[model samples]
Target: MNWDRIEGNWKQMTGSVKEQWGDLTDDEIQQAEGNREKLAGKIQERYGIEKDEAERQIDAFAAKH
Candidate 1:
């Protein structure tokens, strides 16, 4: 989904997001503010993944129902 849709639904989606990125604290997700770029950055920072991989993982997750 696009950033607008993601941001709109962030409150509900954050729970799933937190589950996906177990290492990220709630505060970090809050700081991301539903921006996909920030979320990808945080995922890479917290998980030590490459930027491309982090984006891919997030895109994949976002595709899920």
Candidate 2:
């Protein structure tokens, strides 16, 4: 899905995101608020992964949800 769609549906998409990244806290997810870059950055911070890898993960997640 596109970022716009994801953002529009953020409230509903939270569970799916949580399922993918259970290590993320509620506050962190709320902070992301469905912005792709913010979510990627948070994922990078939480998982200690490279920014590119986090973006790739988010791309895959966008495909799924």
Candidate 3:
């Protein structure tokens, strides 16, 4: 989904985000606020992955749910 849709439906989407990035807390997801860069950045930081890889994982997670 697009960033706007994700932001608008954050309450519903956060669970999926958390499920995908299990290291992320509810507070971290809340801090993300559906910003693509923030989520990807956090994933990269937590998982020690490249930015592109982090984005791909997030996109896959979003697609799954």
Q: What value of lDDT does candidate 3 attain over all alpha carbons?
A: 0.82
Flag clash pairs in model 1: none
Q: Quote each prediction's TM-score.
A: 0.90, 0.95, 0.84
For residues 1-65, write the lDDT of model 3, one tens digit per residue.
Answer: 66678778988988778778899878878888888889888888888999989988877776665
- The lDDT per prediction is 0.88, 0.92, 0.82
Candidate number achieving the greatest lDDT relative to the actual structure: 2
- Please give the range of 10 consecutive residues that has the lowest summed lDDT in model 3: 56-65
Writing each residue's lDDT as its tens digit, candidate 1 over 1-65 gives 76578788988789988988889999999999889999999999999999999999888888872
Q: Is candidate 2 or candidate 3 better by lDDT?
A: 2
Q: Residue 24 deviation, candidate 3, in Å?
A: 0.8
Give each prediction's root-mean-square deviation over alpha carbons: 1.2, 0.7, 1.4
Off by over 4 Å in 2: none
Q: Decide which is better by TM-score, 2 or 3.
A: 2
TM-score of model number 3: 0.84
Q: Give the winner by lDDT: 1 or 3.
A: 1
